[model samples]
Target chain A: MPGKVVRVRRHSNFGWKERLYLPMIFVGLGVTARHFFENFWGYMIGKVKTFVVQYPEERLDYADAFRGHPVLVALESGAPKCVACGLCEFACPTDCITILPDETRSAIERIPKVFDIDMSRCMFCGLCEEACPEEAIVMSRDVELATYDREAMLFHKEDLLRTEEQLGRRIGFIREEYNRA
Target chain B: MSDLLQAIEEKLGDAVEDSHAYRGDDTILVSHDRVLEVMQTLKDDSSFRFNMLIDLTAVDYLGRDPRFEVVYHLGSVEVEARGSEPSSLRHRLRVKSGVAEVPCEIDSVTSIWPAANWMEREVFDFYGIRFKGHDDMRRILLYEEFQGHPLRKDYPKERRQPLIGPRN
Candidate 1:
């Protein structure tokens, strides 16, 4: 029986009860009735909660782990925390991030002249955020970004920079997570 | 695994330039001339039925005498199901040959495996190592109009390849 071929049954020959389908229907209905009664009783008693929240009018808080568009962190001095190390630029798989740095800038020897990130090309893999050693960039919680024009999606340095006051929760989460790792 | 390697080494004496285990995985370095013969033997011969060609890729050693290293990963689909102790699954072979920058050449093992067709094409697309007997040796990964082989060690990073589609 080295190369023995054993054929197994694929289908079960249905009985009369299965063929009539009344019991099956009633069983399905029973499940529905159970849920309906539970919810109905819960609603009447105000014990169990309903998950269906009134959205748009009543917004639920987003978790700190929620990934969204990447933003550059800036201190109170209004200067970008990124030293133009080009780690994020290299780490970006889509090549959406472009950092133009001026070597002549003395006070901050490595300051980004133009940091453009094309959101259209970004797959949001979080490589750019992860590669930032300075903790300059991290994914924000604002996931509701939409625009009709293609040009609007291209985030420049001016649009990317967010102060501590602006990025309260995301920066805190990133700091905690980084410290843990 | 060593017994298997010893058998192969004994069978292919001079053809096998070197053979050793790397990171618990067996590796055989064969001369470029006998690569096809060695591959055929491995597949048809019961002792080493490496029927599956898992991967075929090329490495660029730019400054070395042999500019390219063609690596072959071979195993069998049925080996696992057979409980045959798949030391061959992790085992691989590296064939080295001096491929000149302009007209790099290597005989395609597509006839032996047929899975090597696309893999070889991808290697050709990236490393520009021309396969001798391949039916369709066109670029598999990059566009046909792509200027130079991108995976080459000397390929200029700054050189902008001509964009394919809409600029806007």
Candidate 2:
């Protein structure tokens, strides 16, 4: 006995009715008109209920759990709390993180001399945040990361460091989740 | 093992061997020479119409006689009531002829089922297993210029291939 052969033929009908798509066109126009008139009427009545907003001037409120870019946690002492363990670099599935451990540490035992994250390669998976032993690296809600050059997309340690004030919403969200758990 | 193994053995005597059921899964280990025949029989036979090829992969056992084991998961579309849910009877099969590491070769099953082409290519790409009758036998996962089989046990972990950008 042999394996059975499966034959599947596709039947597509492109008749005259399909060519004259006036009915479908009218149906689509009707839906658009209904939306336009409803939105216009709502605006005239001072309802202030429209789907589209004036972008660049206003933005929707994002959830606290939103994952965007990874940022270094800055301590109250004006120093980043990262221990330069290179765990984030190792744990990065896309290999976007690069942490060069500080060889010359006068007071601190270990810190990153050069911490680089190529934003182009990053998938925003939040694996680095999970890999952080000291909670030094966490995901930020700053998703507006457009740049003119590729070199600008490669964030350095200085650019990535964010104070507790900057990450207040996310820190509180994470703390609340931990407390609940 | 659902009487299917015994029926398969009766149909293709020496081709099927070391078949047993574990955790409700019926797994059969077959010799490499008659693997294509065994797969065809399993698919065409009315009693065991395992038409769907779920997956095909190869496992490298370092410091072993065969060095590599090819795994094939087959499923039949015939649905039957099992408790409250309907389920297909899927069978897992493993085959090995114990070839040397120099040129790991096995007869391709693409003649029976065309779905094995890409799968065989992937196995060849990762484990360096050569399928004799495969029409297009190229690296499916890795670049053509990739130095060595990454999944092989002997392949080094830290061996660096310097490129324009950083390592993946």
State which candidate has the highest TM-score: 2
What are the runs in model 2 whose C-alpha is more than 4 Å off? Answer: A1-25, A46-50, A100-114, A148-150, A179-181, B1-13, B20-24, B79-99, B138-168
Tens digits of per-residue lDDT for model 1 on A1-181? 2454345686588788778899879989999898889888999998756667788698788787888888888867677888888999999999999998766455766778888899988878888888888888888766666999999999999998988777888878878886752
lDDT of each: 0.81, 0.81
Query: Relative to the unseen true structure, what is the C-alpha lDDT of residue B111 in candidate 2, on a scale of 0 to 100?
Result: 86
lDDT digits (tens) for residues B1-168 of candidate 2: 667667777888877767777766667878877787888888888877787787888888999877888888877765664554445455544333444576788889898778899999999998899999998999998877788888899998888754545447
Return the TM-scores of chain A for each candidate in numbered order.
0.78, 0.76
Model 1 CA deviation exceeding 4 Å by range: A1-9, A12-61, A76-123, A131-134, A148-150, B77-103, B145-147, B157-168
Candidate 1 TM-score versus the reference: 0.70
Candidate 2, residue A35: the lDDT equals: 89
Worst window of 10 by summed lDDT in candidate 1 chain B: B81-90
